[model samples]
Target: MSEVSGPVRVAPREAWLLVATFLVAVAGLIYELIAATVSSYLLGDSVRQFSFVLGVFLSSMGAGAWVSRYVEEALPGFVWAQIGLGLIGGFLAPVLFFSYAWLGAVALPLFAMLVAVGVLSGMEIPLIARALKEIGAPEFRFENVLTADYIGALAASIAFPIVVIPFLGLMSASLAFGCLNLLVAGLSLWLFRARMRAVHWLAWALALLVSLAALWQSERLVSVVDASLFEDDVILSEATPYQQITITRFRDRVRLFLDHSIQFDTQDEYRYHESLVHPVLSLAPRAEKVLILGGGDGMALREVLKHDRVRAVTLVDLDPRVTELFATNPELVPLNRGAFADPRATVVNRDAWRFAEESTDSFDVILIDLPDPKNITLSKLYSREFYGVLTERLSADGLMVTQAGSPLFARQAFWSVARTMAATRNPIRPGAGLWTLPYHVYVPSFGDWGFVIAAPQQHRPRAPGLPRSLRYLTPDTWAAAQVFGSDIGPVEAEVNSIRDHALVGYYNEGWDTWFR
Candidate 1:
């Protein structure tokens, strides 16, 4: 292998082919990302869905590479692959969304689309390389084609998270990329018109037209699919970079769903938010400062602000889109009673785990109002390590509470959270362990939901006094919430930590058994 590398001259035709390769690579990776994301959103386990999607897609690409050797005409094969990629990849998100909504099952259809896109993507590079060689270009190396592919993939990886998901959303972004693929096909047809047949021309025109049409109507299509999934008329639907936020209304009742999991129902949400906030706040010796994590909707903030002693409240939630919507939207602002606009409330849009680990200020009460540990990312928030960090931020006599999942439905999960919090020793005094008290409240929207209140020492079980305007959580009801029935009582379970995500498994298994 002598070093014969000078400036390797590429003709205009070969350069165009390389551009097509880059565009195909971008479209291919976008489809793969869309599949993994959609699966994770629908399936409930992000780590598993991403692992399966990556493995299947790479292997299918290898299979496609093997099959590409049989094609006699390289240009025709490349053009057809582009057409197929545009048609399938462009509509992949919409099809998956509609299928999950209508069929109530997406595993079969999701994997099918994944394999089709991967195979077509895999075939593209080989066909492009062969076409480059077939055109008698001067010294065009195979590595050049791969360089364009690798760079294109890098571009897509950066854009998908920063621009695509937040601005265009999954449905529109996929359709837009599909149109890009179709344009690449049309460009290929024009570049090699001498070799293209009449059928290739017709196919290129049809695919481009279809992709453009879909791109134009992508929002309407998503609205239709979303209407099928939700029970009521969807008034607000947004896809943030972090999660999907949906709000629906029927008559006087409104519901908020994050990634299709119900967060609160306006009819009975007072019960949930009241139970989550008031118990620990009522028990704290001097609740001057409060820190709230994951209650972006400000419902918990509303409860916290009800107490006049609260000087300031710092609320940490990851998604600004969520907090902003609830803060400003006229329909939603009333639900939280304009908590975000309060003078004492400070909202920080950042990850709870990172904020907990990095926070320097000590709080009199720390409230963990996060979602269930359905995935590893959320599971970490419920882990032993995260609890340790949170414990460090609590004042000497401070109290902390977390909104644990359903005690009746996910018994192990609820107790596991209690156990994890109990295991968290006070950083100031290693000998003084947290006192854990688990309780449950029944709401009309969600039955048998649980909460865990922990502090340095045992606090009074009965509330000193409650807000007079409270719709739920009277002093008597608060006392009864600590008493659990035998059926939903605690069981032995391992502590959840960053290294071992025991909570996610317990959560998934417990919910799956009940739902199944």
Candidate 2:
């Protein structure tokens, strides 16, 4: 559709401006989400990144809206705004990734992009409304433009999670949306070329060409950035529905990271796996039915199989790719000792919390081997509600153990987990406080990691004799593991509930201190 400034006016279809609004809305939100996701991935704190990004975007939009009154021309300005957003928003992911990789920071560039996109986006809607008004649709201009904007935002929210993230990934998705914005600019320019300036046509062409090239080379760009981000050679990298999975190899050592948090380093994983499994298993010597939650790597399963008494082991992890990789990949098979292939092992790829709600089966021992409470998704697993679900399935005579994060680094968070379990114990019954004990072991890769073992009632925990040999956790080491220094000892903390997820706040606070 075409609209001219001054007394002269050319009438084009109203649908063009409405469609532009829709496309611009989708493109704007996509950039906002991309910035939030990339920052969370790199920075390890979702709540803070998203909060900051949203604040900057909204403020910039206001600034753009206020500044739009100064421009004499409307159509040209609108076209150039779209092109500018496309160029900056489209290249944002790769630029941010590489910036963090090379310069070790993403804050300045990330916020700058957020501001630019927001301002350009803010300017577009008002210009579109004015253009429609100038073309003799002034009466219902606000209603029409507002409706289109809302519809476009709704479409973007729906498409982002379902289509964009799942198929194209964060980086590619950003580039693709950038192309969409540029296409809108080109389409608008082609339709209204008579009303537009030569600069608008040139801007549209340049933005389209740049976005197309970036989309074509998105994979290579991702690879180059990842190579710099990770010290080791990135053997495999992909964006799964749940998380960003990357496996890196440095000589003989292999490392797996989910969402940039290191899961395990093959060289010293035995120490961690051994420590996680043996403490509770030794106490509950007759554990036959085993349930492994979130230990997708199969290292914990290998440890569970070491006991002759374990008749059946159920492994519940959120990601199928993680389980499948451990089960099939030749590089990882040796590390887990082909645990998933064993007759006793059952691999179920689903949310651990949901599986807990549905499963009727009881377990002699439950190992809660999930990631730390770095984000809300993970924080839910560590909530009081989840522990209550575990309480139901846990055999009265059985014991449960969880891999809590580092006591030294995240002291309050480490103890908050203990507090959550304690708070959850007696919620059902007045006198039913859980028999809980906190212990920790130091692995070379992660220093001063903690674990919490809980039982139905108080019983003397005896470190049982193992059927096979262990690389760590002897009787003396086991005794020393329970000893905590004053600094890393218990703190007065709130329970981590599903609604509040107080653990995430505690975790973010405790961890952020170290960086400062």
For this target, which candidate reaches the highest lDDT against the unseen true structure? 1
Alpha carbon deviation, residue 389, candidate 1 (Å): 0.2
- Please give the lDDT score for candidate 2: 0.86
Best model number under TM-score: 1
Question: What is the per-residue lDDT of model 1 for residues 1-516, given as tens digits with 9 covering 90 to 100?
Answer: 887868877778899998888888888998988999999999978889999999999999998998899989999899899889889999899989999999999999889988998898999999999998899978778998999999999999998889889999999998999888888888888989999999999988998888888889888998899899999999999898899999999988999999999999999999999999988888899899999999999999999999999999999999999999999999999999999999999999999988888889999999999988999989998988888888888888888999989988889998999999888876765766678889999997778999999887778776657888899889889889989999988899888989998999899999889997
Evaluate all candidate structures by whole-model CA lDDT and list the values in order: 0.90, 0.86
Q: How does model 2 score by TM-score? A: 0.92
Model 1 lDDT-worst window of ten: 425-434
lDDT (Cα, tens digit) per residue for candidate 2, span 1-516: 797756533245467888889999998998998899889888877878889899999899999988888766777678888888889998889889989989999999998888998998889888888777665653445887989998999998888877888789988998998898888888888877788888787778877887899899999988998898888999988887677899999999999998888989988888788888987888884699999998999999999999988899999998898999999999889889999999999999988988999999989899999988998878988988889889888876878889889899899899988877776664335667677889898887777899998877665767656545788778878888889999999888888888988889888888789865
TM-score for each predicted model, relative to the true structure: 0.97, 0.92
